[model samples]
Target: MNLKKTLAVTATAIGLGMSIITPAHASTGEENQESPDACMKSQSASVFKYAIYFNSNYGGAYRNVGYPVYDFADERVGGSPQAGTQPLLFCHGGSGNNQGIKNNAASVRNKHSTYYAVTYYNSGYKGSSDWATPNSSRNLSQAYNQNASFNWSSL
Candidate 1:
């Protein structure tokens, strides 16, 4: 083909490609950008629940529980515990129902909002204590591992 015809064809192709691509890119960008109200609404639709992993760093067996879990005695609390194995616990800030987790947790992840999940070494929310900040995760100290009796209010 002549140079003029080839150049014209190339320009037309480029223009057509952009026309096809622009709308798709624009729509996807809009979908990905969520408004504050929309984000809050979607978040509220689901209850605030946190997961407790048996292994460290949020791995191994996991249980997603709502606030106010007093005990871990109920087999249903985090599903049946593994046979012949004491799984370490990991959790963020939330209410601990009572004495069930008195001496069971190994680690914790604090993902609560602007509050710390205070873990008590002894039951009844007493004894030595450790606190985790919101949106943080860590392995508990040896003294606190398998020694969490209660989860008190945020710090």
Candidate 2:
């Protein structure tokens, strides 16, 4: 084939490949914003959901087991507590500090029935306990444990 034809064919193939990879709704003229149908979709629409359990102390009198599950299937509408969704937990990225996931109490609570942010500090770091203290970590951990006990389907 001539150079012009070869280049045209390659460009056409690349365009076709990208279109195939893009979602159907997105491939259409839809803007980046999510539609109300997408927004209302619940956690039940998620492909992954599960919980995590841990013990404060293993095999000892002081040991206390806790469950911390992350269920993606709780499809409560975001920012609507009246939707009867499970309490949402927001954990800040990379160290999970207050600044990482900082939000006003009311703002966080508005996401669901209950909302919590988890903060954790690096172990053995010599610094004031005021920032990301162990107590806060434990408290958030316990909250996750309690929330994990629910059957989100009923909510």
Candidate 3:
């Protein structure tokens, strides 16, 4: 073939090859949403009621392998409990719930081997003791200071 014709054919072949090539992308479009279930058994039965009790009575529960929980950050104090060390958790009662908390305190304390007490205030609205007041600065300040005084953040 003549030089021009050979060059033209080579150029056409190169253009076709370049058109077929694809630029690399970071990820594929498809992804698996769930993995195969492991041979894990459910222990949710005990975890649910106990966790609820802890939250209602003790602010929160200690972490366990099979349970999930949450609590107000302002209510808990963390400290190392040595062999003979006595730890305490105070539950401030809301409204006329003093009797309820008082009755449960011993059982909770026994379960944890730690002192549990209930704080009762003047008769007021339901839910939280501090909710009756319009301004929460006093409440927040008290909560922050109390938690800070005991260094609850460390726990």
Candidate 4:
């Protein structure tokens, strides 16, 4: 083939290959590149519905968001009690401090659409624990009342 014709054929082939490949990947609905947290946020508008109310039965100070709240010292929503008096506190893998909501949470609420949160009595997810289901709110029982750390899992 002439130089112009050969170049045109090559370009057309490349274009067609890209078009076919692109659609194949797009149609699979598996091109997700978001992090797990981001994915959870997108899957449920209620993901951000999570909050820890200070008072019982979803009352008092509250923290509402998809991300785990490790500390309540900075949160003063609705004149929330001091860290130690706050109704709730969340902790991840690391061991949380003894003071503050570590052992003073009065209530817990999980508004996630597909995940359940596990609260522990001691920091670092050690000691006793209680699992809070999604879209649910309840007062911390006497045993798990003073929770320290917590983590969540998909349902």
Candidate 5:
């Protein structure tokens, strides 16, 4: 082909290719990125009626609990006696997403219709604690980020 015709074809092809190539864009779509932990099996069996927040005022990543936790640390997870090696963590997409829930929570919501969720500053459900009434939410006053255990009671 002639130089002009060849140049014209090349230009058109380049233009078309360039047009087809869009600028890469960061994904704005949100998805649950939390990986399944070993204790998830037991978690599914629990009620998960309590929400523990990473920030006061019920903000940031949270973990929902159904049963009592003697220690936020390992050796026990929630109400299960399985002695899980994996630590409990907050849900994804929040301020403390994928972070450990022990001693890191600052707020809580009691979703249980008939039970009170208690957060303790010391492990084994002892020491200063903050309680959230059934179906209530509260910013941890004593426990705050020093929380170490959790339990639900009728009182």
Candidate 6:
């Protein structure tokens, strides 16, 4: 092929390859680059959902879980997408300190700019639920201490 054609073909191939390799969040057009947080690469978000608290009114034993979890029992915390996660833990002072987050959260703050933070009462996002709008917070009514799963929703 001619020089111009060769360059064009190579560029096209690289672009196509990038689509597969780029993290999902980076490809969403929200930002041009992947987050620096290691665990963010696989599912890809610049930040964690929000503060899920062990007390009502958004107090005590809070964690910034960086991704939606099927169950808090899944001992994993924010880290490299390639590196395995350690158990999720409270970062500071609180009544529930030293305890795991599974079925323990009572209130939450939603920090995502694009999605509502939804917490469920059963595993796999089933059963009763409560939600906090982006940048908002509220104590769970139905789920309460029974919380089991979590996910984000655009609606």
Which rank order by TM-score, best down to worst?
A: 5, 6, 4, 1, 2, 3
Pairing residues by index, what is the TM-score of model 3?
0.14
**Stretches > 4 Å off in candidate 3:** 1-85, 95-137, 142-146, 150-155
lDDT value for candidate 6? 0.61
**Predictions in order: lDDT:** 0.41, 0.22, 0.20, 0.45, 0.63, 0.61
For residues 93-144, write the lDDT of model 4, one tens digit per residue: 1222223455555667776566676666665445666678877776777424
Give lDDT: candidate 3, residue 103: 16
Error of 1 at 60 (Å): 1.4
**In candidate 4, what residue range of length 10 has the lowest lDDT sum?**
24-33
Can you write out model 6's per-residue Cα lDDT over 1-155, one digit (the tens) per residue? 35675565457535634221112321111121122431232222435555678899977766665555655654333322335433344545659886777678899878777778888998766789998888898999988998877766666
lDDT of 2 by residue, 1-155 (tens): 45675565457535634211112111111111122222222323422121111223111011011111122222233323344433233222222222111111111011122222221121111111111222222322323222322111101
Q: Highest TM-score, which number? A: 5
Candidate 6: residue 81 lDDT (0-100): 38
User: Residue 60 error for model 3, in Å?
Assistant: 14
Supply candidate 4's per-residue lDDT for 139: 76
For model 2, state the Cα shift of residue 147 in Å.
Answer: 30
TM-score, every prediction: 0.44, 0.16, 0.14, 0.46, 0.64, 0.63
Error of 3 at 20 (Å): 84
Which pairs, if any, clash in model 2? 42-75, 43-73, 43-74, 43-75, 51-69, 52-68
Q: What is the lDDT of residue 35 in candidate 2?
A: 28
lDDT of 5 by residue, 76-129 (tens): 422235533445677745698878878799888777787678899998667998
**Over 4 Å off, model 6:** 1-46, 75-87
Error of 6 at 61 (Å): 1.4
> Backbone collision count in every prediction?
8, 6, 2, 0, 1, 1
